[model samples]
Target: MYCVSCRNIHMFFPPFSHLTIVSLLFRCPWTVMANFKGHALPGSFFLIVGLWWSVKYPLKYFHRKGKSSQLTHYYQRLEITEAAIRTLFSVIGVLAEQFVPDGPHLHLSQESHWVKLMNWQHSTMYLFFAASGVADMLTYLSAHTPVGLDRLVMAVAVFNEGFLFYYHVHNRPPLDQHIHSLLLYAVFGGALSIALEVILRDNIVLELFRTSLAILQGTWFWQIGFVLFPPFGGPEWDQSDHNNIMFITMCFSWHYLAALCTVAISYSLVHCFLTRVKRHGEREIIGIQKLKSDHTYQTALLGGSDED
Candidate 1:
């Protein structure tokens, strides 16, 4: 659904050639509906979740380091709040997909069916995530909904997301397909790790791997936005250029490396900071006990009553 005007977005992606790039540059605004906002929104979500998990899983593993506990992973202590946030984001996605002026507004018929096929697809993806959130909420409140149902649902959602994206950008330009296909690596990797979480229960390795992939997803989404839309007022990529595609692939590798470094840094900081805090606390307690012992000895040596 490529259009010359700014109002209509083309696949939340754009530019197949130099001419097309120029057109998008002059026509599209900084916040193009084509997919910049879309990518950034979800990117921010993944980034936050990834960073949080990065800190949390490491902290949990360190805290439980010599303990004889069957579980040694981050637990969803704020399941209720987490579920609410997930549901809220999904709802926003669905509403934005269906209710914009150019949107079909939920109308699916012979005449209106082709209005925006991708929007419907996007809505369906969001629905699965929303279902996962609801499942988490139910698991938190209900006693008989089956253990690990929420995790299973979330794994399905992430899998479905990758499945959709795999089929979403086919027959498109080389650069377009290449850049988007890069996302499949993160999406599918995260999906598999999350599915593993369902089976492994509290395996910190699987959880950490999932969080690392999530960080990749977050950063890559923003990369896609810059490649496709270029919100910072620059020329768009040549969607048919092999050099551009190769560069993007290389750049994606860098993004993954950066994500890994970020995860490692997060773990190190949490471990170091918490370890120092714990050490200081133990020293404080020992100092207090020693003071009490010294006071008792002095009173006894001075011929004071034992009670004194």
Candidate 2:
């Protein structure tokens, strides 16, 4: 039998334990989305871009038949088009924030400097997206593609993502912690992939990892929408039973399904391009032959073993 004083001491010490402290720092009260439109808009952008990248890379890889130096910039026209669309979306989002008087607009003219800063914080995510868009446009528009400029763009994206992660972690409620944490992981993973790409010059695996993270990010956006918004049982902010294991399992299962669907769509698109597009088909065939020849020559030089 434990003494009452000892029991009290144990309880007190447990609350101050490292695990408890970490949980307190990382966790917060559950929060519902007040500005659904703002989230959904950027969410859509990420989803579309992610789906495109995931599909584009695989098709490009097969088309080039593993001879390409850099799989990323192979489709120059598509890159430019994506950049233009991102820039357009960023501009529109910014403009809407500035002009839209009724909706979730930023309160930039608060009397208190602290309040003004907080207002800026609210819009930082969009601002970072806009900055990234501008950087992407500049990257594509440069007359002479300098390595430094490319690194700078990647660095800016990394910083933006880091900031976004912090914002979501602190500002979002505990109920949404899992979704936001997944997004943070995706952003951080993307940043790491970009850094690796910059260092390694061109790594196809790293590029694919980056695109996979993008797909995960997009999937999280839809999950957040479904969990926080209407038509799917409404927000979970006020609920105390958010730690349902079955619900969590379902959420992850949905993500896996979404990823598989994206891959299938990408493959189908690649097949269509190879079958219907005359120029692309011809180029791919030539590229494949060249790759085979190169492999054979390397194998012969290495005494019939291409391992080295």
Candidate 3:
């Protein structure tokens, strides 16, 4: 409820500064490693295979079925979700911005005027999420069994992602939509925590390297859990194949790493576009709408009314 200005700048922080102290707890190195080892491999593979399946087939299916609007509508939903999350994090960023200038745990401010320049970056990111969600749905349908209780569960999960995408694409994307709103964020934030741990010290790479091995082990555990444990039925892997575990484990690790990198790179592109589009002409062009408006003016071409 209170606003303060310092040196020609105005900022807002939550009344409960004590609440934000929890973010400090995230600074611990071992905790980050635990998180990385938890999902680095399994989460990564599941995400990639999921994405690939989504892209390769469902897109065509949707297009053929004339459900492109469903796709667009889903993207719109994701946009709204992004807007909401952006506002929440923007508030948090405003509160934490003052702390970034001092050390290893840097902060990014959402309240800065320059931050508004990131709008296109945010919008494009929403588009990616919407697109990815559609792909996920397609993959879910194409890869998983389409008949049974397990099928229902996968459908629900895929639908949930689709719903989020719908919300995001409609609302004019805000910055935090994809990362903070989904479980995928947990996977990413965990991996990033590991990256930061490495950056914090000269000898940290070995620790990170070791963490990757642990991740591979954990990924195998996840595959076994999902495969052998339930209504979904055990994996079709032949019990007689001696190298199944080893082969699956390596492939899983590769896919997992690839998924993480893909999402990270996707976001990086979002940031890059944001940086380039920050200004009107010098590399960050913003006047296309103006040019569009001018073309609407009554001209010597084709008689006069706005009814072209």
Judged by lDDT, which candidate is best?
Answer: 1
Each candidate's lDDT (Cα)?
A: 0.80, 0.61, 0.38
The positional error of residue 292 in candidate 3, measured at the CA in angstroms, is 22
Candidate 2 RMSD to the real structure:
15.8
Looking at model 2, residue 65 earns an lDDT score of 70
* Global local distance difference test of model 1: 0.80
lDDT tens readout by residue for model 3, 69-126: 5566555454345434433433333333222222123222445543322222323333
Candidate ranking under lDDT, highest first, comes to 1, 2, 3
Off by over 4 Å in 3: 1-222, 234-240, 281-308
In model 2, the clashing pairs are none
TM of each candidate vs. truth: 0.83, 0.64, 0.24
Superposed Cα RMSD, model 1? 5.4
Off by over 4 Å in 1: 1-31, 66-76, 109-112, 302-308
User: Which one wins on TM-score?
Assistant: 1
lDDT of 2 by residue, 175-253 (tens): 5565556566667777777777667654557666666667766667666666655433443444235665347546766
lDDT of 1 by residue, 1-308 (tens): 23454333344445465567556554646336556766776787788878888987787788678472554222444656778888988888889878876676887655433656777787888899899999998987788888888889998999998899899898878888888888998988887787777778768888888888999988998888888878766886789888898899899999999988998999889989988998999999999999999998997888765447
Error of 2 at 95 (Å): 2.8
lDDT of 3 at 182: 38
